[model samples]
Target chain A: MRIADAGDPLMGQLVARYGAEEALAQVREGRLGPGFVAEIAARRGKPIDCERRLAAWRARLPYVDAEADLARGEELGARLVVPGDVEWPTQLDDLHHERPLGLWLHGSADLRFACLRSVSIVGSRAATPYGVHVAAELAAGLSEAGWTIVSGGAYGIDAAAHRGALAGVAETIAVLACGTDVAYPAGNHGLFEGMRARGLLVSECPPGVRPTRIRFLVRNRLIAALTRGTVVVEAAIRSGALSTAGHAVKLSRHVAAVPGPVTSGNSIGCHRLIRRAEAVCVTTTHEVIELMAAIGDDLSPEPRAPVLPRDRLDAESRSILEAVPSRSGAGPATIAVSAGVDLMTTLSHLGVLAAAGYVERTDHGWRLRRST
Target chain B: MRIADAGDPLMGQLVARYGAEEALAQVREGRLGPGFVAEIAARRGKPIDCERRLAAWRARLPYVDAEADLARGEELGARLVVPGDVEWPTQLDDLHHERPLGLWLHGSADLRFACLRSVSIVGSRAATPYGVHVAAELAAGLSEAGWTIVSGGAYGIDAAAHRGALAGVAETIAVLACGTDVAYPAGNHGLFEGMRARGLLVSECPPGVRPTRIRFLVRNRLIAALTRGTVVVEAAIRSGALSTAGHAVKLSRHVAAVPGPVTSGNSIGCHRLIRRAEAVCVTTTHEVIELMAAIGDDLSPEPRAPVLPRDRLDAESRSILEAVPSRSGAGPATIAVSAGVDLMTTLSHLGVLAAAGYVERTDHGWRLRRST
Candidate 1:
């Protein structure tokens, strides 16, 4: 592992020292970090607050110790994932200039693989029981179908979603506003540990930072960007969940909403989105998957997930893909047995792979595609 | 009123004798009625069944007496309104050839005036309390806003809507499947009387005819065509209420549906409509009025019925209109006192008059528009 002084000066170390906004300013100016502060000063149309921001960062510099924080993260069993790292989720690149400098991840699951075919399920912290029920069911169904569920790890609907994915014994990622190791809500500490054992707990902040109200809002974009589509379970008219849905729309990701009782204040935002034609109304988890699928053919409303492409496939999916023969092909059972994967997973993968063009369904079973 | 013999012989008497299909075939062949039988026989490439239908009609003609039916309707205290009558609702013209030959009306309210700025509220007869609540609330709100509410006077949701309008002291038309004189759902005989007392009970069939199951389905089109918009409060996937919404869509009228608990099977049709982007999802009465009001201009879901012109105004609205001055406007209280109407009704009529372009809102109160 590269220490602050040992490796590229333009890494998470600079971000931890200068703060993400200042670090982001440097990146926007095509200057890597503080080393190129003079170059940013020379650039035309640079933010007028640049000097003030730079001075503030300079003042805070002595107190910032990136190497020590990195050590702390390492001690806490967390890994730093910079832009070029294998675990970095590429969908965050949709944010471009606003993308985080790096992520601090906790848990064993590969973040990139987990998000390969993922959908975000999110809603209000003050969710109604109906909201909680729908969120959990949708997450569970999507997870069981081999698609990962992503959510901000908060109380209410988010907590329900995480439990649902785990209940299905499927992959999940809990993106947090606070440090992944810090239990901000306290009540969800057990859930945090559960997610760490199964899925991943992700955060943009360094180790030991606490969550603020603003941080939760700041964290919503990541949840939206990490997934192919987002299903808003339920939200009040001005719920923060709407901001996540807005982000997904700006990113050109399909946004779906579950309808609820109109009388319930929890459903107002969903109905508003639907009435405005801003989001498609979805009732079942199957419908959410249909919308999340890469293929847009078969315009009918019947729930059918499009196949996951090879590049979007998870590690196990790729391994399973290789197990299928090009000529005679293989029965799903044969493929599952050979790949050392479960029958449900093998079938799920084959359905998507056949849809994605990597394989074809043969009279016997499944075979590698002639084109690919 | 002219007996059917003195009027267009091509009207209901022939249809009643030979059936609508056979009579329509004769009409399509350029035959007016049995009087034009020779002309139909003379036509080349005429339908082979024409003569048989014509003979059947002629044989039944001896049993058909238009004068007696007219007398029967009159004796029932119902007025027979054929096409071209001042009391006829012209929006029904949207049906073209499928338009009813005449309407039997039982009420003191003018039919044309009652439907001028009307909305049809309909839903499943097997409505849940939630459906009934929403339908009634929506109907009452529309009624209080000076818009007439129209509905089929059946049990459940239909009964709720009619009663809701009456409770609001607003005009409502009950488009019946059977003769206006006969209440088909005997349970709602009291509701039918209430409608006749406060609004109108309308039927296309002559007096003494019974309601067939097919007749209810056939009558749904009239409800859709008679109003500026149709609000489907609640419906199952196969609810006949959807048929009315479908007819509204076909006729280019605004169609809206109320959102309900997604778990309820009763809301399936409404959810389907909203999900398919076929109907606007409305919750509040304010939203419904905003949809129905023309003054919203482009903000409305559609530009539908302008307010009925002053000449088409009901006797009370006309009196209220006269009470407002051309130069100096008057408050609703003053206008109501002068017009011998209640303040609430006066205010409601003024809102419509302002929307209709006959009146303008001034700093003083309400005034006749310079154009009108």
Candidate 2:
């Protein structure tokens, strides 16, 4: 038996209301598909029809109003992306029944494309200065090399990671435990704004939802599944970063840890992971790229001339490209001021230039693509 | 084809005069046994009989003055320990043809027994304060656990190791590049005297010899081979400590490294060793012992009641034992004054008490063995 496509849009709402997992398990186990909920509702008096469950589920629908949630999401410039959507990252399909009922995306970069070249860098919220520095530098390096940096986007190492990616002019993704509209920590509101401008803010929860402790752990699996690998920069033995690493390990994805002084309590988890051979000890961006690309010919995609043809780009893209330095990249704000374009227009043109391969990100910021 | 042990002991002096390494290869490769040297002397007219080499070898011997060198060693209260002697550490046999013909020693500890359970800790002569602290603390921990600490007798990390072992009252052997009596650095004069009273100061070079750059490197193999394992505390990428770790690896002995800040130059070699899987990463003395002891019931040698019988000890040993506090160990000088014995006598009795397991070294000083 297969889940029917017709029931999905409404069923998706019902599932979201009940939090997809338990309802999906029932639908799967009973071979109920397509019109299952309606069939159960119609066969209410039958013992096998889940009559009482259907009533309880229907009673909750008045509280949901799927169309209104969808309309509100649209109003916020966010979208409810269900299975089979073109923008959906097929990687999530690996989770099978546990896949989100739908993702709530609130930014411009294409989710699938951004994650095609991405890694998740996460660590402790109470990170030390050294940890923050390492996380930022490592994320910046990976970003400069064209990999999107994905993180939980709360504070400390996570905030540093997202900010570093933005500084590199590479798309950064924040897969939050709360709604895309809500920056849970509030401390990272500014960082969230920067990401939404040039990167993405994503979540499984719909609009207006708040984060909980269990939600963060559930969110970690999404962070791990969204990227090619996970790098734990600095984490105490009990840090939440370990949950993401654990998920990555279980999913058979690449897992690595940046080593720090054995004296630092913040580095205990990373050291322990390395000591037990659970994670590769990585100290540089190149090492991390190597770990993720071990079985591929991609080889961290060596620096080479840009792939986009010059004749195809628009005048604005050329202007933005000309404003960008060939090395030691410039930020969008600086580039916009230098290029005589407004920041929003300059950002849109820069995005086009990046996608067209006419420009690239570096640890510093955006730069023209490597010269032919 | 065995190396003929019957070669003249004076011929041994002649062999030693040129150093056995380069010239002995010809003697070994030729498969010549006993009387081969005499036959070479009788067949001196033949070109390949090594006539010129032997003449040069014999010429250097008059300068050696074997009897005088022996007497000077005796005057220094030293003894000659050849391979077959009961005092020779059998681990040195792993060096094969490269092994020293004999070792010169000036100390009280039994060379063989002291090394029966030992680890060599060595690193840069220009070690940072972190390196010194790590080296000293590591050595003390091992000493307290009843493992002898072996090291080179140079400045910096080496000096710190020996002093820490002495403080623990656990024997520490200093394998010198020059004659044991010379104390090449001279700065460690006091340290040498302390070790000589309770540990061992050893060298392959005979009396009247001074240290040279080549001698220290050749000496490193002996230090590496003398112990159950070698731990490089901190070293530059090209520091001589790596040579000892390499020798340990080649001998199939366990090799470990104490990790430190990667930003520090002193820890580069250790990090490199760990990166290349050439050594196990160890942060504590117990981990070192674990790597060295993979089999048998010696699993960290579980803490238990002292094995030494109290009734069997001699009167002086009893006095020294009684003088050693049960906690917060006492120094030999202080213990000597308290036990009513001379310093030298107190050290001798302490060594006996340590060997019998009635006492053990702690980072601070000698302490009564764990009771119950």
Candidate 3:
């Protein structure tokens, strides 16, 4: 519990290379371990102040209580999922040294299974009505397609996404920066409770930890890492949602952004991402699914013009149809002459065109079908 | 005037390969020797319909009068621009066999020069207000940046683009399906007059020719070929604007599409174009310029987060700044240990940080600068 620091890459590396227990024991005893020190220096890209780091760690030792932290989590009905736990999402290992030491999960849904086919939808906390509408619609559609929707637990776009997903068939997950038991926003307390009942509330922080500004930035990496791809519904040019997209880019996951009116300042970040080729411009839920699903498993069909009855005719038939009188009618001989085709060719095509509803037999001869 | 067909690929190729005079004599005499016949077959991708095609041309000969047509054009203040004319846009030659044999221009602006840095803005006649607003904004910006705007003189997006460009310093051209001297829509007569006074009106049709549905389809190619790129402002699923984009793509001209609310039916074709990778997603006029201008010459600067005072600090200085109290204050010795840096290093960085508006010295120690 004392060694879980997502922002401290050097500590994460030490815990990853050496066992968490050994790394903690070394920190506790203030021993001069050459191997651990060298590893830390390499990760830091410079020589580290081992003595100072150890001193800092020792200072926090008095407050560390692994058993008590677990008990506190149990009291809140949340469970701890370590690196090798069955419910642990292995995709997060893609973060390597930056991965959380463990995750605190509070909900009925299994974290690993729920995240197997998940996509993150994140955007501005002060989104416009257009942004909120797009986020919710996208989430609902994705959720109904049997893919879980993941998001932050804040208001605006995140809250809309969570609520939309809840309305669908699949479960939703919100990865918060605060502890699973603590709803930092307080305004989202009901949302958090609803998630706990039906979906999942996940965090790396221990039971009683409160979120800070830095924690939110660090938490963005987890949101990017746990999903197959991340979709930015709406964001300003400097929004924190962009940081999550940056993480997705670094992780080599697909990144997609929903476009809105250029007049909307909230859509600037999305348009910029698209302009820079950092993200794909996604308009509909089917397009999002196409990005998240396997190559050929969920391909979006090409958009096409609605087919007209005359569109089914061959080139010669079309020329003949055009020659047919719109007002009255024309005989095959006159139509053939006007169409520059032989009478026999015109006669045969007229029969086919008539059968296809492009032409009809009138008392005089042949004419274009009224609707066609 | 007899040889001014835009739809006849074989005729265009013949006029291009052999000079117009020679091609005309061959067609007029009904003696298209083997060479001309083979050329026509090659362009048509099949055996030539020599007898029938010749019959059709021979039939129209009685109605053509080259001298009288020129006199009529002179009366209307319209000039004919053939392939070798100095005012002709050679970019149209990229269409090869599909290129127009000649263009009729009726305006003060130079056809070739105005088209030198032009972009076509086209979309649905049924565009929503959002599309019109974006189109005008983009056009005005590009025009102010010294780009000529080209579009059909239609009711919606096209009119907006032309009007916006007219509002800027650069000239705007409208490529019409009908005669340059004739306003097909009638309602756009005033717009055509304004264009003739400041910009230009161009067409392949003769002085008094009227437009048909097929002529509009054929005219889209000219719009695409005349510019550095084409931007689709708004379009329904089967809109004519998409055909213009298609022509732009085939001509290797840059193609961009402005995005609108996904709920808008008029934006469906534009989103489809983006989704299909047929068009780049463009929001601002600067992004459109980035696509049209040579690489690195008119590049749009990458969007960035607003700079903060502490953002300039090096890692050590940032740590020192973080250690400084926000609400209260802390002494150098206390901050050094808290930040895991030596007292001297902390003191040196605190001085640099204070000078940069990040921190301020106080009786107790140092504190973060207000608003910094």
Candidate 4:
């Protein structure tokens, strides 16, 4: 069966099985199989089999002609990498329930390689001159320090990051929430084209798809996942750029924010982030590089340091320690319940463990020391 | 001898014995004795103390008419208070080397009472709207919290601080560099008059002494010495307000600064201070209050907490700790020499001490823990 025809049967089956939103989620997560369409159709009260639906859906497939679009992308010296492609970035998998169906990419460097050292630089679309200058300086510095710059292909801070990265030898990538072939803002057409040539332009949707607010929101995760860190240069309390920072932090990436004057409304979000300790305050290029160095590889699978020393720990202490995630550093009470231990024993064990350097108290709670 | 004549003879002899500047310094430090006139005449250089020269100098005594000035000050309901007066603020003793001769005071509040919880609010004469707003808000809040606002009687931030404090129940104090009867700017005549009526207008110079640039520079120390803390709201890199902050720091008073956008020249000095760790960044009245509470009484003679613990330290560690000031943290080599131990031993001791919680490693260096 043709690819589009094959996809249609699964689409309807998926819709029937999990409803529209769930079906879309399944497709985005690449979980929809060949029989998915049939199952969806059955669930939707449509008793059509996959083959019959395939023929009808094939008529609508012209709007999503991946083969023809690939040819056009090839002509532009770009490539369309799907979810299973070797060049596809696995970090993007962090989106889990909101993963993209495919990615349209244009660049010399593989998307996977870029994602390894990438950091998203985002801020206000209506940036002040100070914001723009800081953004450009940060982008240039990070790019020169071997970080791949990731940003939205929009005006203001995003465009400045792309421009700054282009000034450096390292590559930059612009991830659009819109179609690969379309630059949504139009004003950033030049910057988008430059990114396509010297860096990369990526999009989740197929060619000719229009941009939507929901798409933009969903797209933030992709940027976050494709980076080891995210730096918010300037943002108002409600700026959309903060969404990217949230996603980065959620994905366990380093989040750094630049502080501006307390009087500047544009810096309110950055200040709040720093104040709440959600993000570290960084002022210089070197500090950003240092934070990135400290975070290191995001894909490394090594288990985090233990919250307590295993050798010195007693049964109760061991049980409590085992109950807490090594990285989370949960409190004694949480660990006690998780370990099925009594609270008094847990507290005594914790105190002794802490005194013996077997565990450390963190801002959150008690945590095992990695070293004895 | 009449009070004027006696005082004049003493003043002339003081100028001859100690030189004008040194005599002023002595007077300011309250080191001059009751027999100050006779002592000055006795110590006067013979070359300049000829009988004829002594008569000539004594002839100039009528020109040193502070009592006449006191009479005029009384006419304005402003009292002249000397250093030994019961109502003198003991905190002014902090200006060991740069003390003021005497203070010309106006208003109903006792000078000592007004200085009890005083905090100087100073900044650039050219204040931004944001700066002015923040200064006014801080002044009003601090005044409401029972902090006597002290500031130079200048335009912009200073004027705003005075006005804000005056609007609250607590009276503010204006520490003029000029005479109490003299309004330097002339344009602030109404403000000066109001200050004399409700708030206190204080100056080091007796009546009829014209305001001079050098005197203003010297006067900043009085403001610093009289207050328990100093808040710099907004200042350019070279602002005179920074001089007050410097004096406050030197006097070991709590120095707080408001942070502004790095791009704003007006905030550069405050930011620099925060970055240097010389001043804590305070955003609100509550923060200032908390800082003051943390600082405690300024007049207390007891030393504050020892920056590092000594008894629990090893010989090497003790040497290193001794080398470092109690307030400032220590580095390795300095600790090594002070402990009379080799560098390697010092390092090892430091490692052990750090592990045992006898010392804490900070961003700058290792600091001795105040308690075991």
Per-candidate TM-scores read 0.71, 0.68, 0.90, 0.54
Residues B283-330, model 2: lDDT tens digits: 667677787765753454322223446657775566567668888988
Superposed by TM-score, candidate 4 places the C-alpha of residue A261 at a distance from the truth, in angstroms, of 5.1
Kept native contacts, as fractions per model, are 0.25, 0.10, 0.45, 0.09
- Ranked by lDDT, top first: 3, 1, 2, 4
Candidate 1 CAPRI classification by DockQ: incorrect
Over B175-201, each residue of candidate 3 has an lDDT whose tens digit, in order, gives 998888776789988889989998999
Highest lDDT scorer: 3
Compose the digit string of candidate 1's lDDT tens values, residues B1-372: 111211123344456457656765664564546544444345434533444333333433434567888899888899988778999899987876467877889987899998988999999999999889888888887788788888898887888999889888679999888888786889988888888888999887678766654567778888999999999988887777998999999989889998887678888888888877788889877778777768754243431224435548786677677767889878877666555455666789889878888888889988989997
- Model 3: pairs clashing at backbone N, Cα or C within 3 Å: none
**Model 2, A62-83: lDDT tens per residue?**
3455677788888888887776
| Candidate order (TM-score) | 3, 1, 2, 4
- Which candidate wins on TM-score? 3
Q: Which parts of model 2 have CA positions greater than 4 angstroms off?
A: A1-62, A294-372, B1-59, B294-372
> What is the clash tally of candidate 3?
0
Residue A79 CA displacement from its true place in model 2, Å: 2.8
Q: Could you tell me the lDDT of residue B256 within candidate 1?
A: 91
TM-score of the A chain in candidate 1: the value is 0.70
Give the RMSD in angstroms, all C-alphas superposed, for model 4: 30.7
